[model samples]
Target: MKKKYKERSARFRFWRNIAMFLPGVIVAFLIGFVGSDHPIEFQKLFDRDMLYIGSIILYLIIFGIASTYLFSSRQSYQMMEATEDEDEAYRYESQTRRIYDLATIFKGVMIVPYLLVIFFSCQKLIYEEKLTGILGKYTIPLTFLGLLLLTFGLEHQFRKTFKQIYGKAIPRNSSGAEVRELIMSMMDEAEKQICYEENFDIVFKLSNYVLPISLMAIFLVGITFQTDILLALVVVSLIYVYILVSQYKITKRYYKE
Candidate 1:
């Protein structure tokens, strides 16, 4: 059954790729259709540098969504194995899974304009215009804010759904396995009613999605803009390493007890 499901998902992903690309191509061409009579300054917004900047952002968004999918999928597999009740497991799985889908879809929407950015920037076969750094402008920060909002909502939504799916109270006095099950049940319930549009869920989703992608974006943008590439790389490396260390410490402690 698992193999069958995997096969089906592969097929779905195949079609989904096509679905992702077609709309993007169409939209890029449409946006690329700029007026010819505009002054140079007016045309500058649609010029090469801004276009590449937008492209970098779009790339970050796609990479972020894909990462979110993998992260959530790993989480789901673990939780599913940890879960005792099939119904509750499905609820948990779907809730977490949909968030990934939402991110993927949102990223796809972003890629359309990004392609146009590439088209416009590479028009003269060179990086001629001024490459504006991400912090120098407001768009990346604004999108970061969006992701922040998504991540916050995602966290709270899961917590809020705890009571409905699991017991009224978690089994504090029970065995560890029982407590684990109880918590998983509640978490699964929370996962079921996930709202991608909700402010908190958006925030929650953003928390997981943004950091890595932001790091990658930082590296890529820093390079393209001829800025502090080393700083960006160092920061991301430190962050990911810290997270890994924390995970190891927690798991070691959990098993030690």
Candidate 2:
């Protein structure tokens, strides 16, 4: 019993450390760049053609993250269901699985905005060659959307994953060192599955979140860069309305069912 308890404690601490550290790592590494003031050699951007190339890089990063989340969620759920379970484990898995499914749907819905951004990013560089001249016009909102999905989606999934695995591993009636070891093995499998699900959901959610904002930026560029500001605004507004409505519809479907 003591050995089992120690092993479980060690495992929890490790995963807990990971759960806490990964987000901090992202914040520290990515956000830290903002304070660097070595004077960006604008000449580098010009010479390297980063403007065009950067778009591709951004898109690829977004796609990678989003796909990872989607794949992870489903894979984790399958892995979890493969293991032993109590009533709590089964219930927890069901809830977590559902959330993963919803995240997948949200990921798919994000495409509407992503394609728009690509279209507009291209429009500004290749088609129109005009700049928005404001990072807020595109980047701010994109960042917000990504953060929103990442924060809420990951937390929700993590809670579910932890609850299911932990709950299943230490049932009140179970006994014996060998039995405990078996439970430990099952817990390990469950943990892997949950982690995968969480990551997969994040990819799609993050991608979707940024996709809309990028499109919005593209629309804004049309207004800021060219002659048809009024028309661009109208088109942009309509697209915005469309996205909101789509989300509302999606929400209704899942919220009720």
Candidate 3:
């Protein structure tokens, strides 16, 4: 029965993956077919100025939302501390966790716009040939430094609030072994199993689908924009190197004599 169940589950997963990836494959084929004769004008399709402005606005909005969530989490934590009723305290604790989760999500969301902002900034310098001017010379680097500071500030607050709630201090500069030990100390067997399964799923998806899709998308983008294919090749090469190195290390560790 167990063997039959495993076979059924594997079949289901195979079909599910096909269903998920089919649309993307179809879209890529259609784009290639349609654009084969006529090259797509990306500049006409997308306004660089609008994209730059939109990215900044989106970043600000994500920052505000994440800040609000962090504030609410901190407030809930305070309420949890002050509450005399055990049930009320537990409710506040749950609320705090939920709010903190949202904050964590927005923190990740912020990165997309942050990266877009930097990309557009660099694009401006490259396209305009303004590399020698003070504005162009400092724009990308300054934006990077400023945004990095903001990101680090948000991260620090998130970690501080997390420690307040969980009483687990995640060291700022901990080694891999130390971080792993801290994480294991915080989880029971069930939680650890769930974490392991989730991590496996993430790695499996990345290896099987995400990296391949990304390479294809990057190639398409480079073709469409008439950009340097070297950038796409470099990115793909780095991803392959990372995957190979990770696999080698994992094999070495598990198959050690």
Candidate 4:
């Protein structure tokens, strides 16, 4: 029975992954095929003047939704804290988890608008052939700074909630080693195995597929836009470094084992 259930689950997951992946593949194919003959007027569709405004609006919307989730999680946590009943606490705990999971999705979603802002800002600079003024000069740097702040704020809230739930504080100034130690200390062997498996999946997918595809896309964009080869090389270099680092970590772990 267990084996049958596992097989069924695996089959379902395979189909689900295919379903999620096929649309992107189809869309890319259609775009490349059609665009070769009938090119898109992206400039007309996405005016430089309005790109920044549109990105800002999108960012605000994402921020609002993320905040709503986080706020709901906090409220659930507070309810759990206030309650003495075991049943009530468990209910609130589950509610908090659901809300936090939604909040976590936004952590990835937030990157889209941030990337759009950077892309549009770079496009503006490239076309103009110079920084138009103070805004142009500082736009990329400011967007980066904003992204950094938003990431830090979200992570801080997440850590605070984690501490509240676990009754253990992870120090703000903890080094990477220290943070890993603290996190590992909180996990059982089974939980640690699950975490390791999930991380390995991420590393495997990134190294095997994401990096190569990203490198190809970067070069294609560079060729299409007539952007500097140096810019593409820099991105390629970063991707290579990530792959190397991941390989080193994996090797070190297996070698020790």
Q: Top model by TM-score, which number?
A: 3
lDDT of 4 by residue, 1-257 (tens): 11333446888989987886675577566656656544445366666858866886787689778878988888999999899999999999889977976886886698888778778777776786665556767866776687778768877887787677667987878899998898789778987887787887787888767876676666555444444567667877787787768687768889995
Question: How do the predictions measure up, each by TM-score?
Answer: 0.31, 0.31, 0.70, 0.61
Residues 61-170, candidate 1: write the lDDT tens digits: 66566556546655665686689999988887676656545544654465465555546545633443442556444544464555546444543443333333232654
- Consecutive 10-residue window with the lowest summed lDDT within model 4: 1-10
- The window of 10 residues in a row where model 2 has the poorest summed lDDT is 219-228
**TM-score of model 1 relative to the true fold?**
0.31
Q: After superposition, how far is residue 66 of candidate 3 from its true place, in Å?
A: 1.6
Superposing all C-alpha atoms, what RMSD in Å does each candidate have to the true structure?
A: 16.5, 19.3, 5.3, 6.7
lDDT of each: 0.55, 0.54, 0.82, 0.75
Predicted candidate 3 versus true structure: per-residue lDDT over 73-140, tens digit per residue: 99999999999999999999889988998998999899999989988877877787655445657866
Q: What's the best-to-worst order under TM-score?
A: 3, 4, 2, 1
lDDT of 2 by residue, 1-257 (tens): 11333456888989987885575456545545554434344334452234544544554455555556555665666666776777755765665555555555555555544554455455455544444545734653464466456545654554464455445434335568855476446556766787567765664564455445555455434333333446655765676566656667768889995
lDDT of 4: 0.75
Question: Which model, 1 or 3, shows the larger lDDT?
Answer: 3
- Between candidates 1 and 4, name the one with more favorable lDDT: 4
